[model samples]
Target: MRFVNDRDPLPLIEQLRRRYQDQRQIAYVERAGDAVVIDFTVHPAAATQGCGGANGTGCGCSGG
Candidate 1:
């Protein structure tokens, strides 16, 4: 598991869901009384966006 910020260079959860182009997982949380209900989606690819890493972020894809 990982945490991402709104400004992260990687991508938004929504974006990743789209780019994967395959079965993906999504985590979400909801409030129920005093407890939080965590939920997940088994598939997200069909709803994700095509980023291509696609924007050439200069992260050095070769694992620098």
Candidate 2:
């Protein structure tokens, strides 16, 4: 997933880390003017390890 934000996304990145643990990874793709771009990558093995939805985002899972 590509994230485009108006400002630095440090807090959001921290939250992603807490939510997904090592299951997901992120990297800075770009930082131009007011746009901050980040790539959120999810490992395939992260799918079957938790109680969240198919993408493991806890959107539709009762275990959240």
Please tell me which predicted candidate would have the highest TM-score against the true structure: 2
Instruction: Give one digit per residue, the lDDT tens place, for model 2 in 1-64.
Output: 8999889888888887877777788988988879899998878777565544434456565544
Q: Alpha-carbon error at 64 in model 1, in Å?
A: 18
Q: Model 1 — which ten-residue stretch has the worst lDDT?
A: 50-59
Clashes of each: 3, 0
- Per-residue lDDT tens digits for candidate 1, residues 10-51, read 256567655543344655454445444434443444234322
